[model samples]
Target: MVAWYDPGVLAKTGLKSLLSETIGRQADRRLLDAVARPQPLAFDYSEDGDGKAREELWLDYVSDLGDGWDSTYAVASAVMAPTLEVRDATGQVHHTEGGDVLVFGGDEVYPTASVEEYQARTVVPYEDALNDRRHRPHLFAVPGNHDWYDGLVSFTRLFCQGRRSRGWQTRQQRSYFALKLPHGWWLLGTDMQLESDLDASQVEFFRKVAAQMGSDDRVILCNAEPAWIKQQVKPHAGRGFLDNNIDFLEQRILGKRVSVFLAGDLHHYRRHENTEGRQKIVAGGGGAFLHPTHLPRVDTRPDGFVLKECFPSQKTSRELTWRNLLFPAINPWFAAFMGFVYALLGWGVAANLNEGAVSAPPLREVLSAALQSTGSLLVAAGTLLGAIAFADDRRGKAWQKVSGGVHGAAHLVVALLLTWGVSSVAAPLASELQWSLRRDFLSGLLLFGGGALVGPLVVGVYLLLSLNVFSCHPNEAFSSLAIPDWKNFLRLHFDKDGELTVYPVGLRRVPRRWQHGHSPEEPVWVPDPRDHRATPPALIEPPVVIGRSKAPPLTLGTGQLAPALVTQDEQPPAGPV
Candidate 1:
C-alpha cells in the first residue's frame, strides 16, 4: 500500500510542543516579527493605480501589528508543511504557533481523494499526530484535484463540516470560508476553480469584502494553486485573471496597502521576495511527495525570488530534534537490493539448467518447481515497487523500470530452464510408452510416431510461450495448452563488445540504434527496413573492397573476425578465377 502524511498537519498537532513551549513568549514574538515586519515605504509603492496602493497599505498595516492584536482571524490557505522548528535572526529555535491559521493547500488527498481514500492516505497519519495533541492548529482547506475525485460534495462534507450536516449550504462548506483571527488578521479561503469559468458569486463576494476592509487591516488570499506565482514565473497565454488576481488587488483594491500573498501547491517551500513590489510566499512542502529535483536546463535568468528555511529556536525551546527517518519508509537502496536478489535467482536457475543432473525427482519437475517459485516471488516484488512508483510518479520511473526489467528477465530465464529439462526427459518417457504398446503392432506404431512428434512439439510450444511469442488467451479450445513457463525459453545474448547482440527466444527484433560490434573496425549487418517492419537500421560494416578483386568470405566469431585469404597483390581472388 502507498503511504503519505501532511507535515503541516503533524506540526499543528503539537509534535513540536517541546520546542514550542521552550521558545517561550519572547521567541514567539520574534518569529512573528520576522514573518510580519512592515515593508519599507519605497518597497510598498504599487505600479498600478489607487486600488494597488490601498492593497499594499492594508498589507503594511497588518505587518505592523503585534500577534496579540488579532482576534477571530482566519488564515485559510493550503499546502503548509512546516518543518519541526523555525529559527529567528538570533539562531533561536521557535516552534510554529499551533494557534495560527492552518490552510490545506489543495491536493489534501493525492492521486485521487475519496472519503475512504483520504481516510487511508491522509487522515490516518494526520489523526495519529492529532491524537497526541501534537497538532491543534485551526485547519481551513481548499480542495485540489484529488479532493474532487469523488466529487467536491464529499470533500466539503467531511472537511468543511460534519457529514451529519448534509445540504446545499454545507456542500459548499469547505470550498469557501472567512476566518477572523485574534488581533484582526482576516483570512479568506476559496476553492480552486479548475473549470474554465469562475463562480460569479464567489468573485462578487471577494470584491465586496475587500472594498469594506480598511487600509490598516490585513487580508491574506488563500487558494490551493498559486495563480499569481504561475503568472509571474510561468505565464499562460490569454489566462489573465488567473494571474491578474494579485494585480487586481493591488490596482483595484488596496493600492500599496496589502501585506503578504501566501499559497501552497508546488510541494516545496519557497519564500519569494516581491522586493520589486509585493510579497509572495509559497509554503507547499507539507508531508506530500517532494517536487522534482531536476531544474530547467536553460535557467539563464534568475528565478526572480529567494528562499528561506525556518525552524524553531533551539536556545529558547528545549531543542526538540525529531528523527523522521521512518517517514518516507522506502529508499532507493531497497530497490537496488531487490534487483540484486532477482539477478541471483536468475544466475541460480541458469547454473542448475547447465549442470543437467537429476537425483530424486525428474530434472524437469524440479526445474519447473524452482522456476515457478522464483517467478512468483519476482511478481510480488514488482507489485510492491509499482505501488511505490505510483505514489510519486516522477521519481518512481527508475524504480519501476528496474523492478519490471528484473521480473521480465526472471520469467524468461525460468521458462527456458524448464523447457530444457522437459525436452531432455521427453525422449526417455516416450520410449517407455512405446515399449508398453508393442503387443498391438498398429497401436505400437501409432504410439511411437505420436511420441516422437509430440515430444518436440511440446518443447517448441514451451519455448514459444516462454519468450512471449505466443499469446496466452482465455476461454478457447487451446487454453489448457497455454504455456505459463514460456519466459524460460528466451535467451538474452550479449556480444563480446558488451552490446546485446541477440534475443533467441520469442521476439528476434533488435532494439533501435544498437549494433553487433564494439568498435567501428568490426563487420556489422544492417537490416533493410523494407524487408521487416520491426527491423532497426544497422551499423556501418568495415570496408570489404579487394582493390578491383572480389573480397573473400569473412570468418566471424563472437568478438573477432578473421581476414580472408589473399593473393600476392594482397587482393582476394575474383569468383575463384
Candidate 2:
C-alpha cells in the first residue's frame, strides 16, 4: 500500500513539489509583488435596525477548509450558521444575524493548489454554505503554501478578481488586505508566501499604512502558519527569523502593536496568550485530519514567556525522522536493491523446488513484478541522485550535511523495518503452502512493497502538517495516521470602545458516516471549555483565554491610504481581536 510508484502516492509527491516550484518561487511573485500595489479593499460600515441591530463590524474566520470533504465543510458552515447575540463595540449584547465579513486566514484549498482545486474545494462549498446561509458575508482570503502551489495565479483569480466570490464579493484587491474595522482595530492580512519575507510591495504598502497608526490604534494579524511550534523543537525558533519578522511587522510596519495573532495551519485548536496579553490562536480545525497538540516531551516556555495553548489536546506524530526528507532519491534505490536480491533468493527456491511446475509459475510472476519494479526504480533513483549531486551546494550550510546524513539513515531504517514487519506477518500467513517457492515469493513481494511505502507515508505526513498539504489538519483519533477530528472555526465580535472578542465553535464530534455519506448532518456546535476536551498533553494549559491589558498604547502617526480600498471618510477598526 505504501508503494511510492502508485498514482495516488505520486500525486502526493507532486503536491509537495508544486508548493516550492510554483507561486512564490516563480516570476509570478516578482510581477505580482512588485507591480501590484494595494487596492481599495476596505468596506464601509452602516447602521440598520434599532432592536437586534446596532450597526457594528463582526468577522467570521475559518482556515484550512480547502479539503474536498463534505462533512467537515458542513461543520464549518454550522460554526457560522446560528445567529448569536454578540456584544457590540458599544458593549451592548444584541442578536447579530449573518456576518459582516468573512476571513480565511490562509490555505483555501489542497492537492497542488490550483484554481480548479479552489473552485471545487472552496468556492463551491462556500456557495453551498451561502445557499444555506441566514445572511451573506463578504468573503476574503490570504494564500497559504497550498494556495501558492500554483504561484498565486489561482489565488489572485479568486480573491483579487474584483474581490468577489460566488455572488459574494469584497473590494479586497490584493492577496493581502489592510481592512478598516470599527473602533481603532486593523486587520492586516499579508500573503506570507512561505513566510520568506515581506515582499517589496507588501513592505511599501504596509509602511504607508503603518505611518497612519494613531496612539490608540491596535491590530489583528492573520498569519498563515504556526511557525512557533516548529521553534519548540529547534530552539533557533526558525532561528528567530519568523519571530523577528512578526516583531518587525507589528512594531515597524504596523506601528500599532499586535493585540491578536491568528493562524490556522495546524488544523486544531491551539491558543497561546503570551505574558504580554497578546493572543496567539491556532484554529485550523476546519476539516482534514487533525494534528497532535503535544509531543513526547513537555515544552517549557522561557522566563517571562507565559504561553498557553487551547484545549482538545493530544500528542503529535513523532514517527517521522527528518532523514526521510533527504533520502527521496535513495528510497527507491534501496527498495529495488532489496527486491532484486530477495528475488534471487526466490529464484533459487524455484530452481531447487521440491514441489512441481505449478508452484514455479507463481514464483516466476512474483519475481517478474519485482524485476519490473527495478527498471522504474533505477530510473527514479538515478534521476534523483543526479539532481542531488548537482544540487547547488554553494550554500553548503552545516544543517544540510547533518540533515542529509539523518535522511540517509532514516530511509534505510524505515525500509528495513517495513521489510521485517511485513516478512514476519506474511511468513506465517503463507506457511501452509507446502514450503513452495510461490509462498516465499509472495511473502517477499509484500515485504518489499511495505518497505517501499513507509518512507513516503512518514515523510508525506510531516509535510502535510508542516507545509499544510491538502489544506487538511491532523486527526485527533489517528493524528497524521488516520481519521478526522471535530470541525472548528473562530467568530470575532468588534465593538465601539476598541475591544475585540473571539468565540470558538466546534462540533461535538466528527460524524461517523461523514466520509461515505452524501451530505452529512451539520453537527451541533458548542462553545469552548465545554465543546471539547483534549488528552493530557496539550499545546498549552488555558487554550481559550480572555484578554487583559499589558501596557499602554503607543503614540503613532496617521497613515495615508491608497485611493482604492478606503473611502474618503474611512476610519480604522478598533482594538485587538
Q: Give the candidate number with the greatest lDDT.
A: 2
Model 1 residue 478 CA deviation (Å) reads 45
Q: Per-model C-alpha lDDT, please? A: 0.34, 0.52
> What TM-score do all the candidates reach, one by one?
0.38, 0.65
Most TM-score-accurate candidate: 2
Worst 10 residues of 1 by lDDT: 64-73
For model 2, residues 455-475, the per-residue Cα lDDT tens digits are 444444333433232211123
Q: What would you estimate as the lDDT of candidate 1?
A: 0.34
Q: Tell me the number of clashing residue pairs for each predicted model.
A: 72, 30
Give the per-residue lDDT of model 1 (tens digit) for 424-489.
Answer: 444445456675432233222333333233322332233223222221111111111211110100
Q: Name the TM-score of candidate 2.
A: 0.65
Q: Which stretches of candidate 2 lie over 4 Å from their true place?
A: 1-23, 26-38, 45-55, 80-97, 163-167, 236-246, 296-305, 315-479, 512-577
